[model samples]
Target: MSEEGSSYDWAHKAFLQAFLSKSVMTVDEIKPILAAVMSARDPNRPTLEGDVTAPLISSTIQAINERLTSVDYEIRSTKDQTNKHTVYALVNTTSDSLTQLATTFTPDAIAYIKRVLDCMFETNNTRNREVMAVTSIQASQLAKAPTRSRQSQVGGDEDSSIQAEAAVKSLTIAESEKVLADLFDQDFIYKSRANYYSLAPRALMELRTYLKETYNEPAGDDEDEPAIVRIRDCDICREIVTVGVRCSNRECNVRFHDSCATQYFRSQRGNQRTCPKCKGEWLGDLFVGERAANKGQRRTTGGRSSNVRSEEEEEEDEDE
Candidate 1:
C-alpha cells in the first residue's frame, strides 16, 4: 500500500481527532477513548474484535504518528514524575513560527508562561537546590508586567525600554489565577498536595527539547564534556527525572524515578545498593522536588514519629 493509503484509516483519523481535543492522556484514560472510537465506527462489530487491548492501542498510535510525522507532530509517551503512571502527549516535534501561532494562548499569555517556566526550571532549579517547582503564591506574584530600570533607560535607547515595557501585558491577579486553572485543566501543569506548581507529564514530553536548550549549559571547555543540565534524566529509563531519588553523593548528578530506582536496585547483586556513576551508597530516602523538603522536615523533627519511618519501611514503601 502507498504511504497515503496505509498511514491512516477511519479509526486512525477518529483517534487523532479525539487525542487532539486533550493533547494528553494516560494509558488507562486512552483505553476508553479507543474503545469509544472503535465502537462508534462499527456498532455491529463483535465484542471480542471491538476490545481495545494494549497492543491494539499501541499499533493505532504508531499508525497515527507515522501520518503525523509529515506535520512534525507526534504522540509521545513518558512516565509521570510523581505517580509513575504511563502518559501519552501529542507534541509538536518542531518549534517554529507556525507552531507558535497554533498555540491557544495569546502572545502575552505565552510570555507569562515563559516566566513561570523560568521560575520553576531556572530560578528555583540549581545545583544546590533542585526543587523544580513554584508555590501558588509565587506564581501569582508574577502577574504584574516587568518594569524597566531607570539605568537601562539612561544607558540604552529610551524608546527601546518603553517598547519593551509596552510589549508585556500585565495580567491581574484574578486573570493569573484563571490562566493557572486553565493550564491545570489543559494538563500543561499540575498542583501538588502542598499547592506547589510543577510541569505536568504533557509539558515535560512536549517541551523536553526546549527545556534542555534553555536551561542546560556546558560544564567544561571540551565539546564532549557533559553539560550541567537543569532537567536531569533518569539513570535507569533515561527519561526526564523531575521528582525522583537523587544519588546520596551531593556531587553526583545521578537521578532516578522512584519506581525506576526501586526496579534498578532490585536487580543489583549485593545488598548494598550503589550509584552507577558515583561509588557512594544509594540512599533511597534522598529525594528530589517537594519530597526532599518533606524528608528534611522529618529529619529535623528527630524522632520515630508517624511521619518518620525506618530504612526497612522505606524499602517496603518502594516495593509497594
Candidate 2:
C-alpha cells in the first residue's frame, strides 16, 4: 500500500467507485460525481454543487492517484482531439496490448482490433495524407483481408506463418461491425459523423506509452534526420495530435492541435507565423481530419458560431 493509503477516507473510496463505474469522464461530469459522493457521505453537511472547486477536485484526485499507484491503476486526464475538452479516465498502467484490451475482448476479437489499429496508425496514416482515421468501408474490408506475417526476415519463418494462420479467424462484416460498435461503446474509439473511426481520449490516455512505442520511432532532436515517425505529438501540449494542423513544409513534421495552434500563434508577434521546426511559413489553414475535408467552410474556435472571427483573424486582431 502507498503512504497515502492511510489517509484514504470513505468519501475517497466512494469517489473511486463512482469513477470506476464509468472509467472515463469529463471535468464537468466529474464535478457532479464528486459532489454527489460528498453529499451522500455526510447528509448533515451536504456538499452542494457550488462546493466542488477545481482545487478540491484536483487534491482529491491527487490523493486517489497516490493510493492507486500501489495497485497500478490511475486516474489520468487528456484533451479530446476534436473539442479540446479535458477528459479523465481510470486506466491500467500495464503497457501490453493483451492487458489493455484482453479484459473485455476474446483472442480473435483482439486480433481483429489489432488489425484495425494497424490500418489506422500505419497503413492509412502517412506523411502525404495523415488522415489517422479509418472509414467503416476500410474497416469492413479488413475483415476479409489476410493477416500480414509478423516476421521481418526475407523468408517468412515457421513461427510467423503459424501466427498469421492463428490470427483473427476471417470475421464477417456483421462480426466486424459488432466489434467496432463494442469498441465505441467502451470509449476505446469514437466514430465521427462521416463514419470514420479514431482513437478516443480514453484510449489515448490509457495507451499513450503503447501507441508511442508501437507506432512512433525514437525521438531525435535533429530536424534533418528522416525518422519514420507515424504517431506525432503536438508541439505545444506534447500530447498526440491526430486531428490537428500540420506545418506547411511537408518535410517539417511539427504539428499542433487546432486549439493549441490558436493559442500558440496568438502569442506570436507577426502576421506571418513560422514553423517552430523548419522556420518556414506556417500556413494556419492546413489541417487534418474533418477540418481538412471542409476546407471551403470558415473555421471557428471551440465550435462556436460561424459568425465569430476565425482563429487567424482573431490572432491578427489581437496583434493590432
Candidate 3:
C-alpha cells in the first residue's frame, strides 16, 4: 500500500490470472484484473472487508503494467498499427524467450562464462587478470544470426530491449545483443576495467557454485579478485560505485551511487538539478522499476514517441 502501489501479493495475483487464462491479453483485457487489485477500500489502511467495488486503477495502470515486467509479464505495442496511437498488449515472459538463444549461444559462450566464473572461486591467482573478454567476433557469434534491420532513434532505454524481449516466432543476432544489453542493465553482467565483459559479482558467487557442481571443474590457481564482474565508475565520484541510480534524461543520463546522488542533490542548494543532457528533470526516487518508470510508454527527443517502428521488428507486417 505504499505510494507506488508496491504490493507483491497483487502482482502475484495478476500473473496467476494471466497464466491461467492461457491467452495473450491486450491492455483492454487486463484492465479489469488491475482494477480488482485497486478495488481495495482504503489503500493506506488494511481491512478485512468482503467484496468491494472501487474505481479503476487508471492512475497507476500504466505504472502497474510496466512494473509487471520485473516478474516476467510485459506490455508490448500491438504490432501492425503504425498509423494510430500506440496500442499495448500484455505478455508472460521468461529468460529463454528474452535472448532467443536458450538453445545455445554460439560455440562456447556459456561455457566460457562458466569457466571464468569458476576460476575465481578456486584461487585468486593470475597476472592481475580476471573477467571475460567480449571480443567483437565472440559477441557476433554469441549473439546469433544477422538481424533484419535496426532503428536509429531511441525512444527510451527500455523501449528497444522490450521490443527484442517479446515472444517471437524466430530469433536473430540483433535480438541477442538486445538481450545482452538488458542483462548488463539488470546487473546480471558488466564490463570489466580491462575493456571486456564478465559476469557480475552476485552471479559470480551463485553461478560459481552451480558450475562447480554441474561441471565438476577442478579448481586451478588462477588469480583475480573475489568477483568476476566489476562495477563501472560513478558519473559524479569518478570512482566505481557498484550500486547507483541513473538520470532518465537522454542527453545527460549520468548515473550516481546512492551517496553521490545525495551529495549532488545537496550540493545544488538542496534543489534538484536538471540533467545536463536533454535538460530533463532529475527523477526524485532514483530507485524505481525501469519499465514502469514512464507508464510503459516511449519517450524520445521529440517527446512521447508515436508510431515510429523499427526495421527489424517482427510480427509487424499486418494490422491486428
Best of the candidates, TM-score: 2
| Ten contiguous residues minimizing lDDT sum, candidate 1 | 297-306
Backbone clashes in model 2, listed as residue pairs:
none
Q: Predict model 1's lDDT versus the native.
A: 0.75
Q: Which of candidates 1 and 2 is the stronger one according to TM-score? A: 2
Cα RMSDs of all predictions? Answer: 7.3, 8.5, 18.8
lDDT of 3 at 124: 17
lDDT of 2 by residue, 68-106 (tens): 999888988899978989898898887764466777877
**Per-residue CA lDDT of candidate 1, range 1-320, in tens?**
12422456897898888777876888777877777767766678632433666677777888889988998899999988778788888888875322352366777676677778888887667554567888898799887767852223556576877776778787888888888888899888899889999888888888888888777887788778877778899988999887888987767889998899889989999899999998789867677776754546223333445345643454354342
> Could you tell which candidate, 1 or 2, scores higher by lDDT?
2
TM-score of every candidate relative to the true structure: 0.81, 0.83, 0.25
- By summed lDDT, the worst window of 10 consecutive residues in model 2 runs over 292-301
For all candidates in order, the CA lDDT equals: 0.75, 0.77, 0.41
How do the residues 1-320 of candidate 3 rate in per-residue lDDT, one tens digit apiece?
Answer: 34434444555356445534532334454556554554543466433223212222333444555667677655443311112222333443543332323343542344333333333322211111111234334454544322421332356466665554341223355654665565566444665454344444323222332433442333456654232322234567554322345565422336565666777777775465766555578874342112112223223334434344332221232122
Please identify which of the two predictions, 1 or 3, would achieve the higher lDDT against the true structure: 1
Candidate 2 C-alpha RMSD relative to the actual structure: 8.5
